[model samples]
Target: MSIPYQLILTFISGGIICVIAQLLIDLTRLTPARILVLYVSVGVLIYAVGAFDPMKDIFGAGVTVPLIGFGANIAKGVREAVEKEGLLGALTGGLTASSAGITAALLCGLFASVLFKTKSKRM
Candidate 1:
């Protein structure tokens, strides 16, 4: 596909996914964290069923920039590990695939905590 069309698709798809998440937030009691986990699980299921490739192809970054993409990445890593390391890969593949993103988040949070003053929310 051409770059312009891909960009357009990405914008629309990303916005749609966000809209669905927002609606879930508004309509359901589920926390945002749970919703995010759900998205990742869904992504993993889709990837396992061989459905996520077309999504990645069409939605590109729209599908990939979110937690669902992270799940797909985990699933992919697990598949590779399963090929190379058998059951051990099933245990460690997701963590191995996701460590960079996890570490980046941790480091960023650590930096922010050190640099900024903490304020307790008044509820």
Candidate 2:
């Protein structure tokens, strides 16, 4: 199937994010996981405030294509649930919506452990 523009944009944006984060990691002492968490948290907070919607509208899946896209997805899902279920949505919507990201991360980690030996360095 042909890739849609939205997805293309998402991939590009996501790559840029990763690249920037990688650069930050290389230049500073922060770890990759920390940067990833920071990016996701910022995305979530921005999304919760309703600012991320316009970016998504303009860029389509482009904005949602990256790791932080999960955060946007969570915000979007929560907003929709809140619209339909009110306070109850607040209880489960975000987790339910953002499950894909979490699952992906977990699966990847499991795969890495099975495939590679990660020994901590003892100096």
Candidate 3:
């Protein structure tokens, strides 16, 4: 049996993204939070330059499952909202587009917290 080409591409793309993050962690002074913000900002910039869709087409979920994808989704939502709802879209579009994911994250966190016991780390 042969692996599908798309699967290979997806793996490579996602792996590369992860590798970059790992390298940042190993080599840089920047905190993880800053890296996360940087990635999301880069995503917005990519979308602003009209490159996100083509990259998404090529990379599939590899491009859409990361923080960058979240950023792009927000940009996309805002753009569509602005087109349909005028100025108000700017205020609501990102949250509107991201609501489902946000809700899922919240629900999952709630479930996890209820199911597990936590201890404070002694740092």
Candidate 4:
């Protein structure tokens, strides 16, 4: 059986994103937190320039599942909110657009904490 072309593109795109992150970890002094911020910022910039939709169309979930996607989602939310709610949207839009994701993350963390013992890091 032949592999689907979309699947191949998805794998390759996602892999490239992962590889870039790994390289940053291996070769740079930047902390993981900084790298994450950098990625999200890049995503926001891409969305600002109106490149995100095309990239998402090509990369599918490969683009949408990453931190960059999260940033784009926030930007989208803010834009829509600003259009609908005036200046107040800027303050609430990101959280509103990302609420489901934020809720899931929190619930997952709660479950994990309840289910397993976390080890404290020693400084």
Better of 1 and 3 by lDDT: 1
Point out the worst 10-residue segment of candidate 4 by lDDT.
1-10
Kindly list the per-residue Cα lDDT of model 1 for residues 20-99, writing each as its tens digit: 99999999877999999999998899899998888998899999898889999999889989999999999989889988
TM-score of 3: 0.88
User: For residue 123, what is the lDDT in candidate 3?
Assistant: 88
Question: Clash pairs of candidate 1?
Answer: none
**How do the residues 8-82 of candidate 3 rate in per-residue lDDT, one tens digit apiece?**
887899889878988998898678998889888888889889999998988888888988999999899988999
lDDT, candidate 2, 37-106, per-residue tens: 8887878887988888887776666667665677777777888899999989988888999887789999
Q: C-alpha displacement of 13 in model 1, angstroms? A: 0.9
Report residue 22 deviation for candidate 4 (angstroms).
Answer: 1.4
Whole-model Cα lDDT of every candidate shown, in order: 0.92, 0.80, 0.88, 0.90
> For all the candidates, what are their Cα RMSDs to the real structure?
2.1, 4.4, 2.8, 3.2
Query: Could you tell which candidate, 2 or 3, scores higher by TM-score?
Result: 3
lDDT of 4 by residue, 1-123 (tens): 134887788889989998899899889877899989999888888898999999898888888898999999999999999999999999999999889998999999999999999789999
Top candidate (TM-score): 1
Top lDDT: which candidate number?
Answer: 1
Give the TM-score (vs. native) of candidate 4: 0.88
Better candidate by lDDT, 2 or 3: 3
User: Cα lDDT of model 1 overall?
Assistant: 0.92
- Pitting candidate 1 against candidate 4, the one with the higher TM-score is 1
Worst 10 residues of 1 by lDDT: 21-30
Name the runs in model 4 displaced over 4 angstroms: 1-3, 119-123
